[model samples]
Target: MRIEIIAVGTELLLGQIANTNAQWISKELAHYGANIYHHSVVGDNLPRVVEAFEQSRKRSDVVIVSGGLGPTEDDLTREAACEVFEDELLEHSPTMNKIIDFFKKNNRQMTMNNRKQSHVLKTAMVLENSEGMAPGQIVEADDSTFIFLPGVPAEMKSLMNDFVFKYLTEKYQLETKIKSEMLRFIGIGESTLEEKLKDLISKQTNPTIAPLAGEGDVAIRLTASGKNPEREIADMKTSILERVGHYYFGSDSITIEEAVQDLLVQKSLTVGSAESLTGGKFIERIIQLTGASSICQGGLVAYTPEAKQRVIRVPKEIITRHGTISSKCAEEMAVQAQKLLHVDIAISFTGVAGPSSSEGHEPGLVYIGIKVKDAPAEVFHYYFDGSRDKIRQRTVNKGFELLFHKLK
Candidate 1:
């Protein structure tokens, strides 16, 4: 079924509130194999709302509208629907009684405008709202189904779960299901990953492959529509992993830090960090997850040469010879951190994240060090381009990326 979602609110257009209702509705409908062709946002003006409804009714098999259903004067969605469908407005007696009971139960005086919530289309099926005062409505005309829901997120979700899902299933006889899976990767660029999977992407039909660039990583989303799509999706994932599996970290909703935490718990290993440019951000991410106290040994933010020498005890001679942004300094910091914090693994970050040069070195020049117990320290160098915050954020992600591979 071709479905179009329309959001009615002046706040959405004015950037006062987000139009999250449409996003949630689209996700829910797509699971039942419904095609969402367009999303529209119209202000609270009556004429514009009528126009939006008229356009959607002509082209779409299903029209789902959210917002503009309240007791205030700006609530024009009910009136607009009546105009577009050429239906009469009538008072829903059951809904009116419910509203009156709610006010009496709360011992509050009912205003004249509150009665507006009880009015709905004459030919529409009334959906009683248990969460709020305004009721939802469903109108069927000329082979089109129109659903009007509340703008409040909690009320809208409650109605969808309580009544809408089962109703749609019974009326449309929904059978085929749409499923999507995400494959997350680090230590690889988006362009390179796409080039590696060009052949499979070109030959795609059922399950389409889409590559998306995230904050500091890359992801591939696979979407399939069928009665049973798990096997086909697994096969496609296996094919993609065969070519670029080394760069793959985890799947949907799994952050790199969480992946590292899982690996650490499995291996029964403890970790620590010594920060210079990242300022404890690397370890901060680790402790954000639950049960981190079991694996984290804490970290030190040695932002300057003096702090590195005094707190983490990086040798003063190394800093004097190679400076703080060098591989030698980073390696020393990691080795010292492992010794002081008594962890199985230690990582260090030392970089010049700036818009200006430091110590005759250009901005975005960074070195990261990793040292495992009884093993020689390894240092990696990178040069990034962006603002100071971006450079520092990327440094933290790269630390997790390196740790993920080492733990594997």
Candidate 2:
């Protein structure tokens, strides 16, 4: 089914809030084999919303709208929907009782405006909202389905997952369930990764290949539609693994830090870091995952030359000669951190992440170092292009990438 999303909020248009609801809805709908052709953002104006609804109805069989479903004067989603469908609004007694019960349970007073949330169009099927006061609605008119959800993310998600998805799935008798697998790749540019897998992508049929680029990483999503979700997922996994097994790190929700943490636990290894331009970002990411103390020995933010010399014990002479931005300095930093923290492995980042050159080195020049037991310290250099924060983020990911390869 061709679906379109209309997000109604002046705050979204003014950039006060991001329209993440549209993105989330599109993703969820795609799982049921719905094609999202258009995403429109209309301010909280009735005429513009009606025009948007008219346009969406022309091309889309399903129109899902989010926002403006609040207990306030500016909230006009229900009224606009009623106007479009030529339906009259009526109070839903069950919904009204639920809203009243919610206020009573919380020991809060219900104002007269709160009663507006109980109004639903006569032709609409009220979708219960257990999370919030505003209930969602699903209506059919002119052979097109319109689902109106609350602007709040938690309420919208609950309604969609609990009611809307099941309703559509049953109504359509959807035989083929769409499954997607995301293959995460680092240490490679998106263009280069696409070039390597160009042939597989060109001949794609059942499982479609889509490449998305993110900060310092590339994600290739493989989607397949079939009656059996397990079989479809297996086929997608096998096909993608055959093509990009070497570069693939993890799937879907698995992050690089989680993968690194799994590896650390598997090998019974402890890790330490000496940060320069990254400023302890590497360790920060590691610790964000739980059970970090089991694997993370310690971390030192050696941002300055004095910090490097004092904390990690990088030799004063080495900093004076290599100037804290060289591969030699990175190597010594890692080695010194390993000795100081007494960890199984040590990673170091030394870089000039700035708008100007540092120690005769240009900005965005980074050196990532890794030192392991019974192995010589190794350093890798990278020349990135972006702001200071971007360069630092690049260095942080590069540090993890290097350590991942070393552990492998």
Candidate 3:
């Protein structure tokens, strides 16, 4: 199926915020084996929106539009859709009653403007929006299907996941199932990983390989389309893993922190951390997982030399002799954290993540320390190049990568 995404807003053109809706929609539709050829952004201008709708309807089988389904004057997506489909706007009573009940429940006055949200195309199937006030509409006109959704991302996603996907599946009776696996790799650059798999990528026909660069790591998305493509996909995955399996940590939507926590839980081992450059971000990521409290002992964010000495009990002499950014300080911090938290493993992060040099050391200079139970502490050094946030993020990722390997 040929699908086109149209995002309606002026703020997108003005660079106020990104059109993340289109990106998200395209990825979701790709799972259904839909071919998304065009993504368009149109300001809240009626004529242009109408033109975008017309163009999409002419070339695409399904047109998914986000935004401009509000109560305000500039919200004109439904209006423009009416013109293209030659449909009349009629008020949906259930949506109007829901809006009224919402205002009454909130103890607020209901304005006439809000009534605009209850309108839909005369010949459209109203998709109830559980997250917001505006009800979505699915209108079939001529040969094209138009799905109008509220611009609010949460509402749009809820409708798409809850209703539209099932509707599309039933209507099309899709025979070919599209399956994808995301193989995540760290400690490797995107270009280097691509170069390593260039032969497989070039010779790909059924199961295609695409390398995607992320914040602190890279991923390869392997997609296959067929009634039964599992064995072929698994074979291709085995081939790729044979070459670069050492750098592979986890799979689709699995963060490094989640991977570390899973390993800890499986081994029944507890972990703790003493963070400097990354602050409490290391433990913060771990605690975001559901069962993290069982594996995560504690964390300490000792930013200054004084804090290191007082809070986490890093020896003052090490800071005075080697400074806070040195391997000695990092090892001391990890060893101290292991003693303080009484965990099976401890990690420390000390780095100069800055836009300027600190203590005669350049930015991105980092030292990570790992101390396992009844074992000597090990320290690693690295230098990364990026903004302060990027350097800090990389430091945290490297910490997880090291821990992942150690736990393995």
Candidate 4:
């Protein structure tokens, strides 16, 4: 089905609140093989919402709307849907009584404005909200389905989980299903990866390979449509891994940090880090995961020269000879961190992230170091171009890439 999602609120346009509902809904619908063609955001005005509805009806088989369901005067989604479907606004008596009971149960007064929420399309299917006051609605007209949900994220999610997902599955049983699998990679540029997969990409038919590179990350999505959808997806993943398996770190919805955590748990290894340029970002990322205290030993923020020498105990002579941004300093820091934090493995970062050069080194110059028990220390160098924040962030990102290889 060609689904178009409409988010109705002035707050979304004004950036008062993020339209996270559309993102969540799109990912959920993808599992059911639904084609989400477009997303429309409208203000809390009746005329604009009606115009948006008119446009959506022309190009889509399903229109799912979120927000603009409340007791306030600006909540006009119900009126707009009624106008588009050519139906009269009628009071749902049970809904009104439920609202009255809700106020009495809470020991509060129910104003007449609250009764407005009880009005809905005359021929709509009522989806009683378990989390909020307004009831969700569904209407069918001219072979198209329209679903209206509250703007609140929790209410919309509950309604979908409890009623909407099941309804869609039973109502529309199409023959073919389209499934997509995302392969996430790091430490490799998109252009280089594409060059390696050019022949396979050009010959794509049943399973199409699309490379997505944005927001400082690269991903490849293999979409296949057939009877045996899951099996085909697995085969595609295996084929792609045969070519670029070393760079592949995770799959759909798995972050690099989570992948590392899984690896550490499997090997029963604990880790620590010494930071110079990344601050505590890498350490904080590890601690954010549940049960991290068991596997994550500790960390040290060695921002200053004295801190590095005194805390992590990187020798002052190494800093004097090769400077703080050198590979030698990074290796020493990691080796010392393993002793200081008493971990099975230690990671260290030293970089020059600046608008101007630091210690005669250009901006974005970084060295990431790693030292594992009874193994020689290793260091990797990289140069990234962007703002200071981007450089620091990329330093941490590259550190993860280097560490992944060692874990294997």
Which one wins on TM-score?
A: 1
> Per-residue alpha-carbon lDDT of model 1 for 1-408, expressed as tens digits?
888999999999999999899899889987888788999999999999999999999899889898888999999999999999999888899989999999999999999999999999999988888899888899999869999998999888888888888888888888888888999999899999999999999999878999999988899999988887777789999999999999888899999999999999999999999998898889999999999999999998898899999999988999999999899999999999999999999999998999888878998999999999899999999998899999999999999999999998
The better-scoring model by lDDT among 1 and 4 is 1
* lDDT scores in order: 0.92, 0.87, 0.91, 0.89
User: Model 4: which residue pairs collide?
Assistant: none
Q: Write the per-residue lDDT of candidate 2 for residues 266-349, one digit (tens) a residue.
A: 999999999988888999999899999999988989788998899989899998887899989999998988988899899999
Ranking by TM-score: 1, 4, 2, 3
Better of 2 and 3 by TM-score: 2
Tens digit per residue, CA lDDT, model 4, 1-408: 889899999999999999999999987877777778999899999999999999999999989999998999999999998889889888889889999999999999889999999998999999999998899999988868999999999999999998888888778875567788899988678998898889989988868899988454589998887777788878778888898988888888887878788889999999999999899899998999999988899899988888888888988999899989999999999999898889999999998989899999999999988999989999989998999999998888877777776787
Query: In lDDT terms, how accurate is model 4?
Result: 0.89
User: Which residue pairs in candidate 2 collide?
Assistant: none
Model 2: weakest 10-residue lDDT segment is: 227-236
Give the total clashing residue pairs for model 3: 0
Residue 135 lDDT in candidate 3: 91
lDDT of 1 at 55: 94
Tell me the lDDT of model 2 at 250. Answer: 87
How does candidate 3 fare on TM-score?
0.80
| Lowest-sum lDDT 10-residue window in model 3 | 26-35
- Model 3: lDDT of residue 311: 98
Report the C-alpha displacement of residue 13, candidate 3, in angstroms: 5.4
